[model samples]
Target: MDNNMLILSEGMHTSIQDLGRKGYRAFGVPISGAMDKYSAILANKLLNNDEKLPVMEMTLIGPKILFEDNSLIVLTGADMAPHINGEAIQMNFVYKVTTSDVLSFGNLKTGARTYLGVKGGFLTEEKLNSFSYYEGVTSKEKVQKGDRLKIASIEAGLNPSSSKIKVKSAHFKEKKLEVTKGPEFNRLTKKHRELLFSKEFKIDAHNNRMGYQLKNKFPPIKNGEIITSTTIPGTIQLTPSGKLIIMMRDCPTTGGYPRILQLTDIAINQLAQKKENDSFKFDLESSFDFLGRLVNRFKD
Candidate 1:
């Protein structure tokens, strides 16, 4: 029998995602992948799969899946109260499931997304060198009920020891996101700059894969719009009406709003776990220090 999992219910929003496409942003393609990359990687690592292997990313809620063959799996990010065959399972721990075993989830304990990783990863369709599903870029934007997702077959005789690693819960609970000054950071008035750091901004309901709109507003910049500057995930823009928008995974390649600050990669991952109405403060870091840390990370 083929190794596949039948999706009985597509809970909220679920999609197959990897590390995301590379070098396609030049063609106006947005990098759409798992919102919580750190958690996704952890899920794959627990199963001894490639860090970039595609996994099931579940948002808010999770799906109900029925296994058709024996497989190894792990769940990470957000305690959605996962259960297999009516038995609750622990997050971040590897488990083996046989055919006919059912997997499901309950209420969200914390965080906004959950990642499920198979032993050899899900065999989803790939485009532009990624399994990430994006509208107009992939055949399917998200998984739906009655879908049969193909998975790599696992060896029946293989028996791997269970993982003992424990990820810190701080990533999901962190409220201060680290950021660096953007190109137009110097154009802001001293009062505006102070407000940016001091004020606790609430995430507006206009939050999604594209970007997040903050509820707090600042004084409109002298020149609100830029010359259609390049933008990537983590670019925070300020609009003419004092609106703040933080670009996310699926944001456009270029934007006209004034770029006020750029979030670090760590901050981007941290912010991904946040949901609507969540409040957070900015922890600005000097450009020189941020650069030094980046260099050290690469050197290590």
Candidate 2:
């Protein structure tokens, strides 16, 4: 079927997200979606969907999906042990979801979120011109178990069988995020500036789509400025305890804190998928380099 959709089992942490709805930010709206957009868009494309098709953005655990009708679907981003009717299914590959069949996501295998997208995509209520879900800004809310999804109508109806799946590329090889010092980057001494990237911080459990709080073994802020003003998604805010926070997709539009460094957009998406204490090195790649690398990462 084209868009006839049914949620057989909504995973514990699932949200409807696309590229994101813009123009709501002035009212404190956030552009929320899969942290790993590279993979997110890849899934949509596999379904022959537009780059902005609404996809199921699942966390470390994926939800079970029951199809009301037959459809071609794809899963991308982090590895959430996926299985269909108890049989293991692969990630980053397109598959067919049949009516009366069950699609279940078990646990987080690698990254934090897994994205599920169907051919064309399921149509949900829109807010500010986007089907991407936010804090219930529209009638639709974050995806939950047993939710019924209405397709765009045209995207549904077509029947499909098996999938000609493609391979996925390495994450680290392509993307680079351009980081600029935060608003309060000046607050930290020169030494702090140097150590911001030089120092290694461990991601803590107290992290969410809002931001990632990193454990600082060596806090560099001494005569740090007073904390005030909002922070961006990639902002690395330093707390009084010297902990550093890297904001993410659902991060508040504003915050009053001493943000010393900002992870570039590309890295924000990449690192967002990282598990707790998953160590990675940072290279101060420029915005130009980031885009160039990402484009080259994929084989044409």
Candidate 3:
């Protein structure tokens, strides 16, 4: 039988995602990719596949998939209580399955997103140099029931022992997100700056792939509107109404709001795993200090 996964049920917001489209932001194209890139990369790494290969990004809930051929797969990011043929399985572990095996999920114990990585990756449509499925950029925005995802057929004598890895649970429970000052951060008053770092902000209900809005607000900036400057993922924009919007992977290439702070790459990944109403505080770091830490991290 041909290698394929039949989606019996498309839970919550499952979609195909990769690292995201690069070099097309100049054309007003947003980088629509995996929300928790660190987890997505981990999934691929466990399977010995290309880190940027496409994987199923499951949000809140997970899909019910049926394997049509022998395959190797792994789950990472969220503790979604995954099961294979009614037997519970652990996350961050590699498992080999034969044809007719059914993969399903139970309650999401932690984190907001999960990555399902299959050996050889999924054979999905690629657009603009990426496999990420964006609404307007791709044919379909999210995976739907009845969708059949193509995969590489397992070869003879390719079975390998299952493997598992340990991941720190604190990663999902982290409440401090590191940030660097943005170009307009200096424009804010000292009070606003202090409140931003000291006060806890809750994730607003409007959170999604486009961006995350904070429930708490600060008084309007003296000069709130910007001259349509460039914006990227993790850019924290302060609106005139004092709302804070944290741009995500699918945010527009440019925004008019005043950019006040920028989240570090690690912080962005941490934020992506947060759900609505989740609370967090900003941990400001100077550019020089951040760079020094980055250099030291690479040296280690």
Candidate 4:
């Protein structure tokens, strides 16, 4: 029998994603991929799969899948209570499943998104050289029930190797996000600059893949118009009305808001795991000073 993952039940928002497309954002393409890349890499690492392999990213809830053949699988990121054949499975570990075995998830324990990776990865066609699903780039933007997904062909008799890794608790813990001054950082008044660092911002209900609306009142910036500027994930823009919007993985290539702060890559990963209503402050860091700290943090 051909190896396939049949989607019996689709969750709130489940879609296939990889590292994301690059070199095309200049043409107005958003880089859509796994929101929590660290977790996605962990899932793929457990199965010894390629780092860029496309995996199913589940938001809030997860899906029920039926395996048509034996394969290795791993679940990471949010604890969604994944199970097989009614038996619970632990996260950050590799498991083997056979035909007729069913995978499912229950209530979310923490975090926002979950990633599921198979041994050979999901065999989905790539758009713009990336397996990520963007609305206009891919034929299917999100996975739905009754869809049968192909699994990359693997040789018979190959079994999954047992492997596990423990993730740090701080990755999901709500804490201060580190950010550096942006292009227009100096344009803000001293009082507004102080407020940006001192105030605790809550993620509004309008948060999504595009951007996060931070619900906090800060001193309004004087109206100033500039040429549209290039932006990527982690760019924090402040509007004239004193609203702060943090760009995410699917943010547009260019924006006109005053770019006031830019989150670090680590901060971006931290924000990706956060859901609505979560509050966090900013840890403003200087690029020169943050470099040594970032290097040492990753070195350990």
- What's the lDDT for all of these models? 0.91, 0.71, 0.92, 0.88
Q: Cα RMSD (Å) between model 2 and the true structure?
A: 4.0
Each candidate structure's TM-score, on Cα atoms with residue i matched to residue i, is 0.97, 0.83, 0.96, 0.95
The best candidate in terms of lDDT: 3
Ranking by lDDT: 3, 1, 4, 2
Candidate 4, residues 1-300, lDDT tens digits: the string is 778989999997899999989889878999888889999988898888899999999999899999998888999999999999999999998888888899999999989999999998999878898999888989988999999998876677777676578889789985899899889898999888777888888998888888999888566777654579888999998887778899999999988988989988788888989998999999988767788877888994
- Best candidate according to TM-score: 1
Candidate 4, clashing residue pairs?
none
Q: For model 1, give the 10-residue run with minimal summed lDDT.
A: 156-165
How far residue 43's Cα lies from its native spot in candidate 4, in Å, is 1.0
TM-score of 3: 0.96
lDDT of 3 by residue, 1-300 (tens): 888999999999899999999999999999888999999999999999999999999999999999989998999998899999999999999899888999999999999999999999989998999999998888999999999999877677676556778988767999999999998999999898888889999999999999999999788988889899999999999999989999999999999999999998889999999999999999998778888978988994
For all the candidates, what are their Cα RMSDs to the real structure?
Answer: 1.2, 4.0, 1.6, 2.2
Worst 10 residues of 2 by lDDT: 167-176
Put down candidate 1 lDDT per residue, 1-300, tens digits, no spaces.
779999999998899988888889999999888888899999888888989999999988999999998899899988899999999999889889889999999999988889999999999898999999899999998999999999999886766566557777888889899999888999899999999999999999999888999998778979888899899999999999999999998889999988989998788888888899889999999778888988989994
Error of 4 at 214 (Å): 1.1
